[model samples]
Target: MHTYLGTFIGVLMVLTLQRVKIGPWGGTGGHAWDEGGHGASAGGYTGVRRMSIGSSWCVSSMLFEYDDNGKRVKGTLQGERDNGIPEEELDFHGEVLTHMCGYHDNHLIRWLQFRSNRNRTFGPYGNLGEDKAGWTRFEVSMEHSGSIVGFCGRSGNFTDAIGVYVAVWNPERFYDSMRRQGVRVYRASPLRMDLRQIEEEKKKEEVERGRLQKEIKEGRERLLKLRLKLGVDVLQQYQEIVQQLERGREGKRQTIEELQVEHEQLERERGRLRKELDLKRLRESRLEVELNHMQTWWSKITHL
Candidate 1:
């Protein structure tokens, strides 16, 4: 009977280990920014509660769920900003949370805090201590003016400070949601950071790096092709302009030659006219002298 009982206990332990999820476990506590001055309440459930104060720019909501054993199994945090908070302000909010509650070590706590008021504070025990086991998975989403632009998820062992899986979407949304909302989204392969997992991650990283490098090289090649095409077009245009200039110069030269010919013809005509006028003047003077001689001869004959 004792052997049977021992066997049962061993089996039970194995089952428990299998059922328990391993990862950073923590909770957050705060007030809702839009709750009309009311502080955050868990609604009778034990988990993190995020809230905000002062303005709608800091509105947020969070939920945490635990199993019957009081172990945190799931958590969700959502932050919404509609008043156009600056990136620096967002970063400062995160920094303040880290400084005040050390949430970076365990993002679960950070998620709990999300975008609460600057004066709000949180801790793992204060929010999640009731749970027998800490959080095994975390999901976060942030929105701007009713547009869901950011999302993230993490799960795994916290021994190496890296989760088994991680994902991020539109991380730049917080910086300037008006311009950079939903522009950048990426997912990181689950990382355990164990010796084998690390090696696998390294291999994956190398492959990703190679892929990125190839893409960059291809982009550069495309750019070069475009530039070369543009250069060719520019050269063609320049050659056409030069040809037009040359044609204009040729036309001007032809016009100048024609003008010169016309000028020479005019000069020749002027010389001939001048010669005719001089001959006419000589003839008139001869006629005048003849007339005067005839008159004198008539006077002499009459006197005789």
Candidate 2:
């Protein structure tokens, strides 16, 4: 049994090799298979084949690969380098890309097909003149199969307008290069969030934010009030100090005036005392002269 299984596996490998040599399956979906055949004959793609879709306002390019049957197998949606797709529109682009490439069952012809059928889906806005256009370009391989199928171009008319520009690539080479560079790919299922739930959460957050803002404002107001009260107290204290200084200055002034009056009275008294002393000295001098004369006369009488 083991020998039989080995033989079968060997035969399958031979068939696969033979198929690779012959070329891939015929192209489908209206695109010609002749180019695809040539690529398969070359064993792999030599360069990049790019395709641009949509008008100037909402436009994109895709690098992609078709399976043996010419159906889009895998691709990469790329954004412009300079005027990149708006960050808000990234999720919308990603969703569309995921549906096209990740979900293998979906039929994706153009980027516009990826837009939601609901009314007023998001997209880019403004005049779609040639001057306002931006594009993203990538190469698709006709040789190998890939995980990406195609990308879609879309625009939104919402307040936050968005433009999607994508570039697609052959996933086989992309994965091989990543493997060579030791890049690991982790696969996870996409999570769907309800719009109502998102809106509710946003409302809750806004309420909390408002509460915090109010607290901050109240705190500032309280601080301002305290500062004003302190200012008033300081002004009152300053006024009291000025009043005390004024009172001190008036008392000093009155004391100086009293001292000046007393000084003047003392001066007058001193002048009167000095006049009395001069008169007394003059009387003493007269008495001394009279005594001298009397003595001289008495001496002469005694001699006679």
Cα RMSD for candidates in order: 20.7, 20.2
> For candidate 1, lDDT tens digit of each residue in 1-304?
4345323332332222111011223323222111110111211112112222112211122223222122323333333332432222221112111111112323333223333223333422223333435344333222321111112223222111211111112235432542343222222212212333457568999999999999999999999999999999999999999999999999999999999999999999999999998999989999999989999999999999
Clashes of each: 8, 20
User: What TM-score, computed on C-alpha atoms, does each candidate reach?
Assistant: 0.38, 0.34
With candidate 2 superimposed using the best TM-score fit, by how many Å does residue 102's alpha carbon deviate from the native?
A: 40
What lDDT tens digits, residue by residue, belong to model 2 across residues 80-105?
32243342221221122211111100
Over 4 Å off, model 2? 1-198, 297-304
Worst 10 residues of 2 by lDDT: 98-107
CA lDDT of 239 in candidate 1? 100
lDDT for 148 in candidate 2 is 24
Q: In candidate 2, residue 295 scores what lDDT? A: 92
lDDT (C-alpha, whole model) for all candidates? 0.36, 0.36
